[model samples]
Target chain A: MTAALGQSARSVLACGEVRTCLLPSFQALDGRAAAQLLRLRADEHVRVSERPTMYALSPEVLTGVDCRLPTSNGSKVRAVGTVIARAALTEGRLLQSTAYFSAPAAGPDTRRPWGQYLVRPGLVEPFGKLPQQATVEGVLRGAGRGELDLGTIAEGLLTQLRRHALLDRRVPFKSRPTHLRWVARRQPEGERASLTNFTVAEGGLRTMELRLPEDVPAAAAAGLCEDLALHDWLLTTVQQMLDNSRIGAADGPSVVEALHPVVVHLLHLWMPRAHVDAALGHLWDVLEEKPGFSRQWEKLSRRIRDRLALQAVTMPHQAFSPR
Target chain B: MLIFAASDKGGTGRSVTSANLAYHRALAGDDVCYLDFDFGSPTAVAVFDVADAREAAEDRGLHAYLIGEVSEPERIDVWAKTEHQVLRDPPPGCGRLVLMPGDVSGGEFATTDDNLRRCVDLLMKLYHEFDLVIVDLSAGRSYAVDMALEATAQPEMSELTARWLVFHRWTRQHVAAAASLVFGRRGIVAGGVHRGHDEEALRGAIRFVRAAVPDPESPLWSQVSPTQSAWMRKTDGDLKQLASTAGIGYSQVLGSVPLEPVLQWREQLITDEDVLDSQIANQETWTALSRLAARLTDDKYWEEA
Candidate 1:
């Protein structure tokens, strides 16, 4: 990012290009460490969104951890602590555990892929962190022209958290985040909440927090028990938002809005018999749907067009030739 | 549509017909995949004059896939060998010819039927991604032939619709082999002819190379008569009756291309003109052949024909 920006004030993070990355999350990895990993993706010139914020995940999976005041999901069975790609890049670490995968892993060959991967293995569970906390030790490695967008990363991690049922609260079917909690920790607030982050301060009012509630359903809770692609999608959507915002276009909210129901439909499409085949059919049907349900998607897509207009993006011409 | 081209014997015009038909289909703007499956000698690759396609075969050449090397099956390359051909270039949308060249270096067949089936599976995948798949099978029945036929018979084999075409000269022996290889019940050789050798010419090799050697006036033609004529009559009778039994008939038999040496030389790199004048105009021999190629793609023309 520093090299590509080359003293150009336009960007020192991303060199001003629209990059489509299918990022993976990790467990036992810190947010700073994940940021470090992001910086290593120097192949594409990325333009950082001005005043972007970090979004970290510490989604608490119901487990053996103790609470000062007894929590609502009961005393607990065993807490699954995890830190994935989003958590590692956002708040510096994750609070809970989930099956997180990483990218371009320089670690032991865990059969991880390099780019836009569907499944790339990383730490199995908690990178050893707690909620509302940042990791100073064992952290990720990445730095841009400025601080990374952890909020978008955190949002993306929410998808993994939701998919892996890493959250402490029960989610309803067809549930979408009606509101986002932007609590900034260690930093002052920015231009707008579109680049929202949980603002955690030492002795200040703006600190990151989660909304835990009583009367949350068991099936919704049980949904947290199963691994779902929708959860992955949720995090991916956030990453898309963060990436776009970094280049001065944040599409997080609308994509979240459009995809939430689609996610639900996708979840329900899975059946015991021919589960994969049936689910794909539903997915194709919805993906190929012309004149999409809402104009919000079109509005965002147009913004993507404008963003794409910002630069000369290229894939190796050799990649298209048959090997 | 997938055109599985095969012949009972070596001298049969299988490759010639296959190349011409593929040329026409490709010319019509259909993305075509031409796979040379003659694993033994791989005559189609040489005939298509794409034998040198080996230069581009580090990718998934047909041979490489058979040997478990490449993952992606590439298209046939229209090599520069056919520089002297009639057509300057093949048909238009006429992207690069993805020639899945044969295993020239190996000189061996697929290890097993399963491996040959894998080759067909790869071809079918190409068909799904492309508009047509043309498989040039070996001269005689081989595992490649069985897999190709089985692929066509099985509905779930591929998204590509299929038509089985048997190429043969208008000679008695060629026709006999063609009829028996596919007509009989057990697999394709239901009523098809068994292996037999042509008699040594006491006089000399017949020079009317374009025409069937057994001239009616020749005494060798007489010596060939009674049995072959009886067999031809029986083949006609059995095919008529067996069509009902096997639930398929001679109508499904696409057509036969003539044995024309001049036309056969540039068989693989079929020019638009080569097929236009010869593959279609040779009425006595290739009469039904051009019509067959025409119907393979255009469903409306098929309705009209």
Candidate 2:
């Protein structure tokens, strides 16, 4: 009986974190292909050359170069994006990147809503339900002192997005590109530096040529985009799983396991004061009758340490304690 | 593939270069994870400041995971912290480079030897979650070095597929010492250890390099680089000896990050000559570096039979 008590206690200790089945989040569904997708979401990297963005104002003062700041981590990464606007002396090249969604922006739909999307200019195709509003995420990567543009990766992304029916529109030609001004004298080989952003308009990719948001401290605000995406993806995934569970029967524990992070993120974003308590409370009750959920959660992560244990039961406001 | 950034010497830009390479690749749209396996220094925190990373034993870290102590993998706040360090305006969505920071607790560095095996398992798990894993070794090749090698080696211990050695040296003596250390009596001389190079091929194949503190004002910094031309081309014998001696490949010989004076004095971080220039200048160096990074990406090289 003593040994049995020890085993049970040890099991309880191991069962601190939640264990739910890894269910497919509906947010990733294209609503077309039902193929099981090994969804590998990618983060973009745009290295802004350390060179200053050059402004023309006409050819006289056009001698200066445009460059963004360094990373706060003391890295040499530069920002890259579509040139949203330009002011010879103000915003040299307003580079911006955007993402698109297919659902209505209501309580964060099943599809993860990236605050914005990399939509094609002038073309809002049917992407399920979310609106095709593209907003440039954070500067994913700063250009190293060594990287060069052999291939217009930006254009390639736009083109690929177009082929995938992901683009909103195209920009026009006669693209009078605004450029980064340079040092007084020009050097040879490898030192030839210049960069500019272009807008994806109805015609083709074109420079915004006006009303550009000046450098948004790319390095300082990096990863702002991915975190939001991750949050959205998780919540939408959780919501979808919850929706799906209403139809075909689903394993209680497994569904909760993959979705716990999503729900947690949602609580953190939408209702932080009670997210953990609420989640843990609901889970404790939901899982109390289902030993399988607790057992499986404990088994899968018997060795994992350092996370707050989920309270087995909900508590009144005064009773709900923080770990 | 696992790219081990090691140097017998300290402060050789191991962490910085590792971080930048991963950052650049992620910008190319590849998934990358940077592991601060430099448990000894644990500088990724001071350097990158992963806000969520505990510089102590308070929470889950590389330490707990290696000892089989962690219940779940630590969720580093890349977006809130180092992720911003990678991009200018924190790329709106997710980022390609993810960081697996080392334990901040200085005591964690005194890890037991066998723990490396567990660490490799953890790294492998992370690898499946990322396209590339960059390990910033503790200045010297500690147990972490052995773990990296074994992790990438063949089943029978013939060679490592995802293996590449970056030797950072400034002066001739440092360069020569780097070559010797990696090619000492019990060094890379253990021939046919891998399929790449032999002793004779490795003599001059040592990847001699200086830290990346560029003094744009200097003549070397101002001119067309990569055209800096080798001080002297290695003869076939010299090349063979270096390659064979070091047991590396010509391709695995990731070149150098030029010694920028700006880096020498400030040694803060790499940016442009000034913020004025655009179009990341100097093509050949980054290209060569990129090629080296690309090699570390192929899984066929590291997986055991």
**Highest lDDT scorer:** 1
lDDT of 2 at B59: 43
Using Cα atoms with residue i matched to residue i, what is each candidate's TM-score against the true structure?
A: 0.41, 0.41
DockQ per candidate, 2 decimals: 0.01, 0.01
Off by over 4 Å in 1: A1-323, B58-60, B77-88, B91-97, B107-117, B152-155, B158-160, B185-253, B266-290, B297-305
TM-score of chain A of each: 0.20, 0.19
Q: Which consecutive 10 residues in model 2 chain B have the weakest lDDT in total?
A: B153-162
In model 1 chain B, which range of ten residues has the least summed lDDT? B201-210
Q: After superposition, how far is residue A1 of candidate 2 from its true place, in Å?
A: 16
Which CAPRI category fits model 2?
incorrect
**Tens digit of per-residue lDDT, candidate 2, span A138-161:** 111212222212112222222222
